[model samples]
Target: MAYQVTLQPSGHQFSVQPGQTVLEAALHAGYALPYGCRNGACGACKGKVLSGRVDYGATQEGALSAAEREQGYALFCSARPLTDLVLEVHEVTAVQEIPVKTLPCRVERLERLCHDVMGIWLKLPSSERLQFLPGQYIDFLLKDGRRRSLSLANAPEEDALLELHMRYVPGGFFSEHVFNVMKVKDILRIRGPLGSFYLRESDKPAVFVAGGTGFAPIKAILTHAFNQGLKRELVLYWGARAVRDLYMPQLPERWAREHANFRFVPVIQSPLPEESWSGRTGHVHEAVLADYSDLSGVQAYVCGAPAMVAAARRDFVARGLPADEFYSDSFEFQGGPGT
Candidate 1:
């Protein structure tokens, strides 16, 4: 049996199968709902259930608190509606059209962006072409049927190489192999182009908030913007613990110098005394809020740690930034063998 699901405000309607989650049904019906970490670890898929009972399957307690559940909030990615439902969710129209694909790729190169961050490039088979949006991600299929997710750091261009920024997690099976054992020419299976985070084509000014290596997708989006000759004002706020963590600092600086509409702000949460640091300091999102008090006309792309992404979404929306205009991808590492 299928249950009718209606979205509030927009009044868009879709049908959900008995076993499918709200998000799956919405996506299947061509409605792109805001989401990240579809596994229910991140709260990015949270939405208000207006008038239906839903069974939230295996959701982490921290992802949605008891108080939130009592208030009719549910994670669309994990919630299965029991009856016809009315929901309130922010839909992203721009990214709704990106297609998804699964393909095999060979490792072409591995460049160390930092001590712990590696820029892994994969070359698609000559017979295949990977069609994906700039800020989407692909999941690496493991031998045991498990998967590890990583965002693309390069835009879809004529070049058939897909770039990924992988952060090394000590004791992680995949990270250890990637840093110590993985080599060029290795064939890896991937299923992807998932997630709703992407550049929304708009004339409004853009604020890009990146934490740690979350800069990967943002980099792809920025490059795409530059290639397309987007004239909208852009400010990139990249945050890291130290100067060394801000990998590819030169790229943003060079981009800002070349594009009159672009500005780069590298923020450090902690700086060594000998580093002679002089720039924005403290939290990266706070820096944006301090500089641009009125976000009523700005669009923000936030990608990074779950904490940072969640905080920015709440604070920025409260400060007049339209909730629909704020797109984000929260990187959540499942502490497993191949995470």
Candidate 2:
């Protein structure tokens, strides 16, 4: 059986399938309901039931008090609709609504995603949670009074461990340390939920272009879009110097296979001599240009080298894409070791 659920204020409606928690249904329906630790440990998803009954399922001992439940409040993360329901809850629709936090985190795990890219996972204190837009980044506060900014590679909903993709820069400060010295259990200070490069709500098709480690934030954005069950046509053009540079290609390949609305195009600028390759070649944006002559109706999210971003902006706008609909974030390697 299924229950119809309506959200107050926004009037957004979705159906809650049996055994699905209200929070799960809302997110699967593209609604951004505020939540933390979906396991019912946090009360961040608590809201008024408005007009119907729910079976509060496994709410932690202190998360939903008896008085709170009696007053018609339920933790959406742990509540299941017993009848058609109307819920009054605040939705996270803008970046400003989330707070920027500076917290201490331990390097929980690390993996070499590619020859030059080191994947780092940071675990925050048990009581701390960082809510961020999918494509935002964080600044790692280094001991030498320097800060290194890296886009978060994981979505807010999957916040158990924050993910960062760091590309090694020869003799560069942070990247070298990340590759050579950083280890699990190392304490690092970070401040963020920063940057404004996030997905905008639109019915237009989306074109994502990523270069090098710039794939980090784009991966997060795409995952969030998928989780929301977005119906818009989505495509990605990931550009790399060689096949080896395209780290984690299988994940996007999986997405292309699973999401009918999605398409993935990998463009390699140069392939190794021994590597027999057949795929799109040249600039990543050029692949988009070849497929799309008119971008007037689509939204483009691009991240990568400054030169590529500039070229895409110029060419895409010339192709009729609205300037405002083009969103981008670019990174450059500094001489001394910064991203």
Candidate 3:
């Protein structure tokens, strides 16, 4: 039998299926309860059980002490509801509510997504969790006193391993290292949960335009939205130089197939004759303009090079999108060893 769990303060309620941990059920029910590690090892999911019995399945004493257990504390990641219960825990609602941290992470895995794009996964220390808002980015603190920033590609709900997509920049320091020398189990220092480009609370439909590897943060935002069961309509225009440049197009395609309110359109700027492609061809923003004659009712998020972002901002605003409804993150690759 499933047990109903109620959250204090917010008064939100969800069901905990048999054999499921509180954190797992809460996440499945679209609640963003704070958690790290998702195991008994980390106390990030520790919270008070206001009024019920729970089977503290495998909770480590180091995470939840005997005294704390006597005080009604339990690690939701390992706790199973014994009956209907009430839980008191703060939900992550905004960027400011999250703490920025400098943590050491090991390169857990690496895969080349395409000719120029590489997928990197960083595993944080088992005792730590980097709680962050979707769409925020992190900076790599290099040994040479240089920093490289990359948008996180995974949603907060799936925090076991952080994901990043890096585009190889020729002769660039970080890009060269990643493409040529970086290896699994290599330790690196990073600081973040930085940036203000996260999705804002609103009733308006959202339109996203991504260029090249700018798809990284947008992927996080979209995954978070889908996991939260957001009902708002979402459309994405992912642009690339050629079909091959779209490293992870299959993901959005799958989302489009699974989500009723989601749509994806891939735009190829200039496909060579040998490419054999039949789809929207041109700049990404132009595709949006052609489809939606009036953008006054929707929110627009554009991420790409400075030139693309600027042009999209200028043209989108002129087309009726409210100035405040438009958000963007513009980036450029440093010619010298930086990303």
Candidate 4:
């Protein structure tokens, strides 16, 4: 049996199958709902159940607290409606209606950006051109039926190649292979353009918040914005633990120098004595809030560790930024035997 789901405010309606989650049904019906880390790890999919009961699958306690559930909140990624339901969800507006594809790509080149970060370039099949928004990500199809996700580090252009920024995670399955056995010309299967974290075109000034390798998608979006001749003032706050973590430092510096409306601020959590670091210090998001006391008219695109994204969203919204204006993608590492 299929259950009917209605969205509040917009009044859009859709039908979901017995076993499908609300997000799956919404996506299948072309409803652009806000979401990230579809595995229920990020709270981006949380929405209020206006009128119907839902069975929330096993979700991390940290993702949704008891207080949130009591307030009628549920994670659309894992919630199965028991009957006709109405929900309060903010839909994403910049999502394009495009068919996703899974294809094979050849690793064209791999360059070490830092001691632990690698820049990987993948060439698509000549016959197929993968169309994806700058902030979207692709998942690697592993032999054991498992998947690993990585964000594209370059904007979509005429080129038939995709760039990815991968960080070496100690003991991570994919990272182990990438750092140890992966080679250029390797054939890998991937599916993508997934996630709704793309930049929304607006006249308001923009603030980009990035942490570690989370800067990958942000970089792509900035490049896309520049290529499209967007003139809105853009400030990028890139946070890292040390100087080495800002692997592609030169790229941002170059962008700031070349793009009249762009600015770059690199923040370091801890600077080594030999690093001679002299820049912004402390958490990246904190630096943003410190500079821009009021975010009422600004749009923020944040990507990074789950903790950083969560903190930025909470603080930014509390400080007057519209909730709808905050777009984010949290990179989660799959834990277990076969990551």
In candidate 3, what are the lDDT values of residues 146-246, reduced to their tens digit? 98888898998898999999998988889989999999999999998765567888889999999998899999999999999999999999999998899
Q: Candidates ranked by TM-score, best first?
A: 4, 1, 2, 3
Model 1 segments beyond 4 Å from truth?
8-19, 56-71, 94-97, 333-338
List clashing residue pairs in candidate 1: none
- Candidate 2's residue-wise lDDT over 1-339, tens digit each? 999999988999999999999998987776767653455654556789999899999876555668878889898989999999999887656864677789999999999998888999999999999999899889899998888889999998999999999888888878778888989999999998766688889999999999888899999999999999999999999999999999999999999999999999999998999877899889999999999979999999888865677678778888999866777776664463354
TM-score for each model = 0.90, 0.72, 0.72, 0.93
Ranking by lDDT: 4, 1, 2, 3
For residue 77, give model 2's deviation from the true position in Å. 40
**Residues forming the 10-long window of minimal summed lDDT in candidate 3:** 35-44
Global Cα lDDT for candidate 2: 0.86
lDDT of 4 by residue, 21-137 (tens): 999999988888888777676678888999989999877665677888999999899999998899999987556466678999999999999999988999988899888888988
Indicate the worst ten consecutive residues by lDDT in candidate 2: 35-44
Q: Is 1 or 2 the stronger prediction by lDDT? A: 1
- Candidate 4 has a TM-score of 0.93
- For candidate 3, what's the RMSD? 16.2
Q: Which structure among the candidates has the greatest lDDT?
A: 4
Which regions of candidate 2 deviate over 4 angstroms? 1-93, 334-337
lDDT of 4 at 25: 98
Query: Per-residue lDDT for 339 in model 4?
Result: 37
